[model samples]
Target: MLSTSARLLRLASLLQSRRHWPGAALADALDVEARTLRRDVERLRELGYPVEASSGVGGGYALGRGAALPPLMLDDDEAVALAIALRAASASVGGIEATSLQLMGKLDQLMPQRLRRRATALHAVTLSLRTGTPLVDAGLLSELATACRDGRALRFSYRKHAGETTARHVQPQRLANYGRRWYLIAWDIEREDWRSFRIDRIEGGLQLGDLFAPRPVPPDVAARLERGIAYAPFACRITLRLQGSLEELQAALPLWCGVIEPETTTHSLLRMGAETPEGLLAQVLMIDRAVEVVDADAVASDIGRILARMSSVFSRDGARVAP
Candidate 1:
């Protein structure tokens, strides 16, 4: 018979694997009396695992999800799958910051020797097929996230593209990850308006101010922020009636690429802001589908002229022609 501590470890693994188990069934599977099982459950609860219990004949135990995640048990395949996923997430395709990499680091440190070998072999064979770019510091990202979660005001110096530097005091709200970058949506204290700041542009001396209640935000604050980002290049509103499923549209477009309002199950109203006519025209052309450019005629007109010029160039050069 296994010792009590060994039995408890096995029980924890079993419980985590099955997710939920009837009290009697679990006791039988562990080859222990129901009373022993009860003690083990108590021990698990004492160890900070929220093992919820239900009453009645079908009563059982299950773990409750929480903000502070508990240690997870994974088999060989599961571990390999997680490592591969983390490697992909670390790449530029998804705006996933080094958070996934940090978690992977933790996982690697805790992995057993055999599992570590397996992870290493998997990583050696797996190719990301992506060119990684220098990203914002993970330590800074963690600090900003902590400040946001604590509802603390932040002070950071920011640099603009034109080499202008300014100090900012903001009530940090949400940290949004978009294609290779992290953006913070915060209430700019000095400007007296909500503004978005790039994590890459933020300098040191980021102090967390006194905690305060977070301001009410929209149900889809991310979507709104995405619209702002996608349209930031233009000083005008550009509308398009997209002819695709919401999932399809969202999959093709980044969360910060456009302001997508669900029009129906099959389509959505996408409004993108642009700072220039040329930039606005290029945004629509990227869709390259049967989308009707609606709001600003300047965008449609410019796109039409651009496409016509392209058509002439292709005809002259005898390049691959669009049907």
Candidate 2:
């Protein structure tokens, strides 16, 4: 049994950790009888903590929203981890501007000098290497995140890579992050389909007419759809024998870039569909590692034409060009 002071601190910590706790479970967690737990609950109430209790199996003890915000409980590691995350999230000028920087500044003022220095050192040493075409509006991001949290449909205009535009009505299911880019997995209302939209390309997001009953999202839905898109519409499928392990190859190329499958312990097959021979050759040559182009003959004629054009350009400049 803990002393009264220790037990009271533990009780406060437990309440702050979660939204609700069943009376029995709370008693067990505190290692005390139900009566003792009740007394402790009363003590908290006397301290101005609004504790609510309900009767039945589903009933539990929960602290209501107080007149003012209460202090949070975080162990050493949790505090350090939160500080690191806040620093990184603040560095980006992205489609969604996060308020983590302002929050970080506020928290730093309250944090011990030792922890503050550690967080500052980590942030100072980190470097970012990503560059993108444009910034995503933070307002639109908040609107979409709010809709997802509230279980609502959204209307938005999406711009494709080719510059074509389309309107989408969707039941926003979940948002995911892949390679610093955000994606929304939603049930498309107009097409009666499930679709994924790149958050960076969404132009206008508006609340729609009706709310949707949420549906189950398939496990690894993003991976499956990205794989499908990699080879779906291209006219030609070319295979390459890459000289690397499956994990290394996957790191170099995203799932949407090519259909990658393992062949053995170290080797893998890359299946890519291309619109033209020129485009196919350009992609194959960019693998950046030792690889054999097994079907070079299929696109050999087009490669020759590309070579001839390159030769003419080099001759005009009188420059030595490496094939």
Candidate 3:
């Protein structure tokens, strides 16, 4: 026979595991009398679980929503998944690192040795490269995520790259992460077009307004966000013909590094942007393969200067050396 406290915990776990449990079946499962089961249900109610009870031939117990969050009961797989996610979030999502780490520690303490070993192995094998991206407030992320989920209109101040500030009202659609930065993809009311707002650039409080009908977002929101970051946010655009597989090109560069299209089975077209022609040229050179300039009108001079420097360095005895 289980003790009172042990029985209560088992009862709670059983209640959480299913939508409904008949009184007789529940008592049978717990190996308890009907009168004792009634007392357990009362105990759960006092603990704010909102466990609803119905009497008669079809009477049973069901856990319903309460005013406050109750203690969660997670199975082995769910516990491991949550631990891994919290660990990743600690490194990727800014402003929540400390909180995530704290939660991760608590979870690690609660997890069994088998689950803990799996979580530890995953963490040991995975590496997160920090990109020095600007920190976004966790509260702001929560607000935006809620707005996106509820189809709410959000009004917030935004800071442009040129140090200009403007007010924006948008219908929140999705929150995406690219290269360590978080972006909010939404329909800008004033601009009357889809826009990607860097979460870090959103200034002041976010005001959630009346609910709006949800709009259709891009099928591949991450790809759309990547393009917006690479081209729309920069001034100097450069297109190059890179001699490499599209998969290889994608793996070599970050998603926001550029947009790539398959030119052939072994070649790809890469379009990228930067604030300056030199900056754009440098990014093109980072690809570890032969590259042909498809369009060099903007960075011709910069490319010429770089070639000249390389020529001088490789030359010996006032003669250009060929490699």
RMSD list, candidates in order: 5.8, 5.0, 5.4
Candidate 2 residue pairs in clash (backbone atoms < 3 Å): 95-136
lDDT of 2 by residue, 1-323 (tens): 89987887788889988999998899999999999998998898887777788988788799888886656656556778888876565334343234676778777887788878876787778676665443455566677788888888888889865578898889998876655566788888889877888777887557465777879898878665555456545665577788777788888875445777788898998877677777876777776667766655666777789889877888775686776
lDDT (Cα) of model 1: 0.77
**TM-score per candidate, chains pooled:** 0.68, 0.70, 0.71
- For every model shown, the clashing-pair count is 9, 1, 0
Could you give me the TM-score of model 1 versus the true structure? Answer: 0.68
User: What lDDT score goes with residue 311 in model 3?
Assistant: 81
Q: Ranking by lDDT, best first? A: 3, 1, 2
C-alpha lDDT (0 to 100) for residue 271 of candidate 3: 84
Q: How accurate is candidate 2 locally (lDDT)?
A: 0.75
Instruction: Tell how far residue 102 is off in model 1, in angstroms.
Output: 10
Q: Candidate 1: list runs displaced more than 4 Å.
A: 1-6, 14-31, 38-72, 75-78, 89-132, 160-164, 252-257, 273-283, 315-323
Error of 1 at 136 (Å): 1.9
Q: Is candidate 1 or candidate 2 better by TM-score?
A: 2
